[model samples]
Target: SNYSEEPSRHPSLKINAKEPFNAEPPRQALVSSYVTPTEFFYKRNHGPIPVVDDIERYHVSVNGLIEKPKELFMKDILNLPKYNVTATLQCAGNRRTAMSKTRTVRGVGWDISALGNAIWGGAKLADVLELVGIPKLTSTTPAGGKHVEFVSIDRCKEENGGPYKASIPLSQATDPEADVLLAYEMNGETLNRDHGYPLRVVVPGVIGARSVKWLDSINIDSQECQGFFMQKDYKMFPPSVNWDNINWSTRRPQMDFPVQSAICSLEDVNVGRKGKIAIKGYAVSGGGRGIERVDISIDGGKTWMEASRYQKPGLEYIADEERSDKWAWVLFEAEADVHSNAEIVAKAVDTAANVQPENVEDIWNLRGILNTSWHRVHVQVRH
Candidate 1:
């Protein structure tokens, strides 16, 4: 059960745990490097790592409210034409620490490193669904439609129950922009067992939790999957609510990530001498809106400077450019001259003009969902 084998980690990654799979790259990992290699990328798993020794026998089942219930063996699924997409897989709790500072939240305590960007290669979910007799949407979908749910092949015994499953709205499932996939390869190679060996659901723009790993089955229903992940966990609450006053039924699970950014350059303890320093990190917005700009402030939020930009992963194609569809993180860098010791603050604004809230306390919720506040780090300017 020891799944802590270090694949290929960036020297800059900050270790959080060595077993059961937990670790984060420094914030700079998002900005420092353009393409996050598979080895050094952050790995988040909720159960015992399942090792898939054979792909030949691997099969993915697609059922529920469909004209035809079908089972897709690996060969059959792969035989169809293949499509590739570059996407950023981010854990909904990427900056849980920031939320925890305001109030205690439930679930895996992750910092900024519980995310990674990769070029996933597989048949598009839409294409596969068509083969299975699901109709493609030609116009706006009717309201009150049921949701689509995905379950992981990697199962675990729940403390109070049987198994764990995650679900997302059918709108997200079928959205053309959503570009969800039944991914078999990560970064051009077979997926690592720890990441999800035979298959996994890649639900773009939503949290990593909904992108269930080791995907076993896909179900379309008139209601959201009543699993713990959908009905009980990952829900957001008002700022005034606390553990003692929780109203679980009234809250809603988080679907999209709020606009967020972080500082990746300097660790918490290291202080650079007073001079010129480069600040870099990544910013992304949920619901498919691209990041517009990132603002950096040395003295809290009093003054700000725009960070330098890099091209998004998939949308643009420079001759020498890496993956053009930036479903992954967008790296940004800004240079500032340090004159005196001060606290550095960083906030990102997305193309939608959605900016991180000024303070975490204002947005603090019982479950700690959507904690997009200005990222601040204190450093000394010593000469």
Candidate 2:
């Protein structure tokens, strides 16, 4: 496997893996701003980072179960009505390290920052599907066309050296409200090569795996994508089912992540001078659900304080608002008085009332995906 062509990344990024190139921003860098800097955004790749230089030759093929299959070029996509969407893309395996502590699980070890929010600029998938003769809100399945698979240009060993791919329901793809984008821009700038250059899919409110980078081809199918990541990996299995009893067929592909929150201000164990300390971090939920509340417990889980949540600068954040940040994370902040050692904890509740589990053991899975357990950090308050 050749790795000489990997793009240069920010020096501050904490490297988790070197081969497939998975790294995330430091905990302090995550809540620095409402929108994550492009350089600081986490890089999660399955294979070698692909580079797209041929602008004219680069095109996305829309085929499979469509009436009019078409190969759309850059100009063709640009001609469609463009929209900018602000959404957060989080890896399903985010915080896998914490889950592994309970029992070993298989997958890359990711910290608390394996996610980022960005303003994606591109043509809507609903509009692009309309170009292929599929109307918006295409829910009814006539010819068993229910799923939309997105194939990528990046090659990974998981599929025996095949391109990375995943899929979503056709109804979700055709829903303009879903905010599925064939993104060519990130944070008002042309997407860097590290992120999918030229084109990529930005499926808001879903796991980052569904948003295939390095755009290649779009396939409409009767069934969900059968790719390695979709079929074999990213499934949630109970603790009773180990590798021996685990049957991939028993579970479906994991999609939207659960409500999650973490305190970025303190380390795993912080020795802070006895005083009122400021605690800040990010809280988010999946499937278009907004964070309803972020509860902070500085002295273990005995007493809790509701952290003030905000998305925009100097403004209160209200979940369920008809705003673009609905799919984005809310930065929570609070001040707590700690006279001695304390166990800082952060628990988030989505607008749908989905709360993070108090313990990782309850939701522990073999794949180590979606570790939405309450984030706890031990802080040693010194006098």
Candidate 3:
């Protein structure tokens, strides 16, 4: 709607979401750490960023299938035991541009700029649900129970021509390890309006779109949320299905993000004539499986070297509360001696041993959703 607002600027990058003020630093700028500074983090908003000027009056409703429906204000939520998590939020369509290069796809034309890592602070969704009580399925309940839907205060017209809201499965919502949150702060500061001021749902390991912005309502149901965004949009399709032959119903909406990694620097860009060229970037796997190792290859898919990894300290909810492994992106680096032109590639393997798909085409979908192809860049060595 209102795209005229001048977004806050980052010293590093080009701003993409002006009203919500979304921006991404250049690839080289991402090589340093796992926790991306708030200013340099990428933002993805689906509607005019809702501004919450009054925190005291802010209320979040937890309704639907519970015996006691509760409406909690800001103070009530803050009164609970506070917890923090270092996690990464990625748009389901982060690398859509790369997919577009192969075939024209619909939706936001995002570059690699739709992803970012940050330390999210809030009261855990699990804790909140425990206080209010999440309804349990009974003998009379249907065989296939689906999800607990989340709705945002912000609304927009959908591609299928109606209002949009986002949701996630009940299992993900109730899992203590999911570390879903009613996040009120980002990177240790009060949430900015563009980033969901009073409250927002932080669904770790799930796509960013499902992490609804603006505090609103939570409903538990046996069927998926009927919102246009969940039912019609954000669905994935087989590569064979072209725009002309698209069957919307045949495609399933994207849920968990796939294992993915990218090389943040290239050898020829700024490497010395005779020194180690450091390759760095972040690796993450959706569904809470921590990334185990990142493999780098100078000659595209040939020999590989394991990159050194940096793990941030904190409680990683996605990896289970008892587990010490970090849920945020793992900063990885490797040094290699190069003397000629080479096609450098990087791929990550998660604890589950789920590796990134070899090529974009192999996992290419009609909508360009979940484009986690191996990250590749070409470089030339100086003599």
Candidate 4:
């Protein structure tokens, strides 16, 4: 393992695993800023981080099922049109710990912080694809390409030590409106090694797994990449489908996440001075959907109250507003009287009117991925 080369991490992160360095920020710290700091952003790696020291020698090969195959150098890519897109990338396995408690499921034991919103600066993938002779919004290449696969330089155990890889539909890749980027900068600065230093793929509105870090190449394939993460791991399965009777091919890989929100102001259980308790958290919907509203339930899911949400502080957040960032998460805040012990909950509705299911059991899967159930916490009011 290349663990020796791993970069130092923040002291505040709660380490869920040591080998691949899977960790998330303290819940309170996560909601402290509109744009999560680079140091505080959650780190999710399947294997040892790859160290790329030579920026001049780095190049991403773009080929397979295209009219012109080209190995684009780093300098060539930098000269293209640059766009800074604010997007949220959430892990499909986020909140797996909550799902695992229901019934032991597989994969990383993440809390709520397996996601982050950042200003990703890079060349639009649609523009890069054009340089390779494929026009924008062309679903299928004339030579029969259907998917755009991103190959990473990082090797993971899931692939039997092969490099990490995944793909998106070629149509999504070609649609400049999709905002897919070959990102080299994050949060207004050059990306650190843990966040994919030299180059990476930032597929806005998709699960984090599809945003391959340390990108090595791009392939326009006739079908999606047959990588382990794409074919075996990230797909959601019915609760009844245990490892014994599981069929990996039955369901497709998870892309856009459903409407999800979490209250981060208090811990799972908190004892506070009796009075009004302020609640704060974040709400995000995938596929470029905006959060229409966030509902807070002080008496568990018995009843609800609307919470105020915003992306930039002090500015009104209207989901349908033309100037609002469609891909970023909106922070939600609310206040409620807490005279006694209470069960507090929060759930979000996307612009599309998609509401989160109230119970984890209703959406429980064998893989324990996409646990977007209502977030509930207990508050003990000190009398």
> Which of the two, 1 or 2, has more TM-score?
2
Candidates ranked by lDDT: 4, 2, 3, 1
How does model 2 fare in lDDT? 0.89
The whole-model lDDT of each prediction reads: 0.72, 0.89, 0.73, 0.90
Clashing pairs in 2: none
Q: What would the per-residue lDDT of candidate 4 be over residues 16-48, giving only the tens digit for each residue? A: 999999999999987888878888889999899
Residue pairs of candidate 4 with colliding backbone atoms: none
**Candidate 2 residues 1-383, lDDT tens each?**
56889999999999999999999999989889888999999999999988777899999999987778899999999999878788899999899999999999999999899998887889999999999899999974566789999999989999989999999999999999999999998888898998899899999999998999998999989989999989999888887889888889989898887898998887788886898888999999889999999999976788888999998731223232424778888999999888888899999999999888888999988889999998999878666
Provide TM-scores for the models: 0.89, 0.96, 0.88, 0.97
Q: What does each candidate score in C-alpha RMSD?
A: 3.3, 2.7, 3.6, 2.7
Candidate 1 segments whose C-alpha is farther than 4 A from its true place? 1-19, 138-145, 157-161, 312-326
Per-candidate clashes, comma-separated: 10, 0, 0, 0
